[model samples]
Target: MNGQKLLIVEDDLGLQRQLRWAYDGYDVVGAHDRASAIDAVRAEEPAVVTLDLGLPPDPDGTSEGFATLAQILQLKPDTKVIVASGHGARESALNAIGAGAWDFYAKPIDIDALGLIVSRAFHVHALEAENRRLATPATTAFAGLITAAPEMLKVTRMIERVAAADVSVMLLGASGTGKEVLARGLHEASGRKGAFVAINCAAIPETLLESELFGHEKGAFTGAVKTIEGKIEQADGGTLFLDEIGDVPLSLQVKLLRFLQERVIERIGGRRAIAIDTRIVCATHRDIDAMVAAQSFREDLYYRLAEIVVRIPGLAERPGDAALLARHFLHRHAKAMGRPVTGLSADALAVIDGWGWAGNVRELENRMKRAVIMADGKLVTAADLDLESGGAPEPINLKAVREIADRKAIRHALARAEGNISNTAKLLGISRPTLYDLLKSYDLHA
Candidate 1:
């Protein structure tokens, strides 16, 4: 035995004993009914399960066995379920395959044949697990970026390619979309020796912004008691991040254009042109082209600042990453808050997926921090995050009503099971096969 667990959900005492002894290659456990089977699934998370559809109350009926199958899959979608069918239950065996069963076998159990099926399922499980492990980025790869979705690799590639360059770069994205973080990543990638200074053009007052960017000499103004270096001089040997560059006033734009062109600055009261060496990386949510067309922003300065432009996708565009990030945030916050919180409830995860996330990564991070603090149960629920599970109510059509109800019920079971497919099926009082069919019909993932 390789220590791989195999759960056998069979009601027959003789057959159960036969299976436990016959499967010498597996550490086997037996469950006599729906309740025990689901409990075993939640506990053991067995790589494979052999289920017989007939139970005590419905010894001749397929209902109970089928129910066990669904709940098991609901609890663990990756578990390979092997359903047993008698000669008369061949149709049910076929239904098992459609419901996501790994394979099916008829009664008068052929030990060698069943062994082959079990071995294949375990092998597949190992391969898939390995693939997922390999898909995650190594901690040192992106420095600060956290993503498991394959699509984010494209953005990573772009950042890597541009990191070593000295050219001016512009980042375009909605607010709170990690533009500044990426700007820092770009600076780190460049291997620059100086500090990275950042200022939000939109946040500073229009009158004081000029002096903020360029230093003032003594007697230059009422507060100029001593000479002060502005943001430009302060970033002499490093990078200067201009956030919300679109809102920079036109007069200040001319002065900034001079620095980019001359590589030097002059204090407000001093005539000496002081030399500075700094790389410029700016970010904004506005359309600079539109501003240029309307003459609100100078076209010459736009070209100078935008030597390279990177467009960042909103949180919704990176599929699979929302769940990955939500988990990341939950763990991080739970540890910081010293909470016993574990993971997101299935409905909570579903809510994370369903929400538009207009605030992107920042919004997700904030919600997770709050969820960790508010979580009363072991896992974070949609209520903790204040997220709803689905769209608005549907019309009175029977088909639509059934779909809406089915989706909601499936979501509820998944939430209660904490995404345990087997447990979900058990809760629904249906077989794993039936649950799989329903999930497929509703276009939902287990």
Candidate 2:
């Protein structure tokens, strides 16, 4: 057994026995009616279910099948129920999907084709379960950010820890390293009532940057026709994310420092001192310390904003994250675009693992989007991602080859085990101590 439960809900005894025999690896259990299916669900709690829309007492109709689907989902919402029906196949598929079935198969069962769907359903279910595990309360503390790498998880935990405290946080990382995403995650974790507002200092001109951050009164400038709240005011009782804070001009840094010190702001061409309550969270790709030394950025302002400095690792530094993020992006885009792209090809996974993601998660996401649009097959290939599929060259060095093989095997085991050390060790046929030694020696993390 693969140690994964699979529920086969078919009314025909012969078909149920055939299905049970076909799936050799899974712990296959059968049910011929709604009551037995519900009982099996309660007992087995299978991750994936091959549900038939022709249960006993209503074998010719889908009423009992749909009811069983609804009850199964209500009991275990994460269960992947792949409904099968021959009656009005097309319409049944659509209705089953609308009724919360994970996927649908037409009866006249081509076991091979249905097996592929069942496997894909299991893969998707595992991916979703891993995502939920990654976003647990002790980890992410927010949605939209998905990562299983320990390095990134550490960063999220730190953000979650500091969210409730009223302090300035400065995220230092390279461009496209998801600094803004972390900032937003922090805001959400903070439980602030006001909106989370953000501004990219590097994207705005220095002339308009001040007005953008501090707001402007009517006729404050040539184009200022009405009074408006700035990002800080809009973020009152919440968090303000200033992306690329090193890009803030030296002149404006003085005014920003005043706001940090006094918790007050003066809008452009306005005299009233507006008291504001907002948490400051800023990020920058530039070396603010070097800028301070060069007199381009204020040293005082740097101190004010650097109350809690977090250094986020680049994508390359986080092992397995590139492939994980690629899978996440592929699923997101494929579903939104209504594409049938199931997963990434083996060569695509190789490229994702080997490539140094210089543009980080943003580049991975863009590539997945293009691949989803351009892919001709169910699996997204390296070519679909516009990436080189040429496998890494063979090594003449025996030691190098062994190390490479070990790394690849360890990564594969970790992924298969979903980052469970004991399971990974078991998969690799190694003792926990040996696996730990290998992980430390290879600088690998799960």
Candidate 3:
């Protein structure tokens, strides 16, 4: 046995025996009725269940089977329930999915096709379980940042080390690469009592950017009705996150450089210089070196902010994070929106893993939120994400589709098993020799 329990629920004794014979690697348990299925669940806590939606009492209908499905889910929401029904297959499939069943199969079951569904359910369940385990705070390298990729974790560690020095730190990364989040993490680790204030230089108009950074006195201008504290003053005794620092106009760069040099600011229309104790943490997607060489940004200011520069990796640069974050976002948005999305479909996960998320985590979050709201079934499919591949349309040949799926599954299994043939075969519900044969046929290496 592979140490994974599978509960087979069916009233037909012959079919029950057939199922047990089919799944030799699993610890198969039989349940002939709804009551017995519930009892079996309580006793075994199986990871996957193959349920027939035509149990006794309504063996000719789907009522009893649906009841069992409901009870099984209520008892163990995480259980992967693949429900089968011969009556009204389409309607039953839709109803079963709405009731939170992992998958549905029409009766006259093709054991081969059903086996594929069961194997995939197990794979998805395992992935979700691992994601939940890794999502905990204890497993993360930093608070509020969720990542399982080594490169991203390395960036977190670098931030943790740089937080204590209290020097100006500049973060360099592509847009939406979580520069502001890391800036806040640095502030939290610095143990600052004051508030962490953030200002996006690119979002603000140049005319008002100075007043926004360094406050103006009351009646400083025609529209200045009341005295206001600037972001720098608001972040006193804490960290000030300056996003898109490269967008600061050349005219204002002089004043910013002066403040960094003097550790004091002269608010607009006010001569009273204010000495503020603030740590500056700035970020920019632009190349500051290019800006300096182009004479667009002040060299002095660059040196001040770049005292402890850190480069953040893009989403594609961090392997496995796209799928991890996709799952995280799906659950978060589903709960917030009260959607019935239980998890990502195998197709959805594969698309996410293979996608090049140019918009980074922001793009992934937006996609998941949209997918959760738009998904009709219990599981979010790749179609819901609206991120279809930019390449050619899917091949029409059935052989081609099978080949593609097989290659992807093999690659994913190898990754999860860390290139161990034994574990890979177990994950794929096959023997080592079978895995070796497929790998050779597909030209895949473990």
* Per-residue lDDT of 242 in model 2: 95
lDDT of candidate 3 over 32-102, digit per residue (tens) = 99999988887787999999888889887889988898888876788999988675677887789999998
C-alpha lDDT score of every prediction, in listed order:
0.83, 0.85, 0.85
Which 10-residue span in candidate 1 carries the lowest summed lDDT?
Answer: 390-399
* RMSD for each of the candidates: 17.3, 19.6, 22.5
Ten contiguous residues with the weakest lDDT in model 3: 390-399
lDDT ranking, high to low:
2, 3, 1
User: Whole-model lDDT, candidate 1?
Assistant: 0.83
Q: Given candidate 2, what's the lDDT at residue 322?
A: 76
Which stretches of candidate 3 lie above 4 Å from their native place? 1-141, 390-446
Off by over 4 Å in 1: 1-141, 390-446
Score every model by TM-score.
Answer: 0.58, 0.61, 0.60
What lDDT would candidate 2 get against the real structure?
A: 0.85
Candidates by TM-score, descending order: 2, 3, 1
What alpha-carbon RMSD in Å does predicted model 2 have with respect to the real structure?
A: 19.6
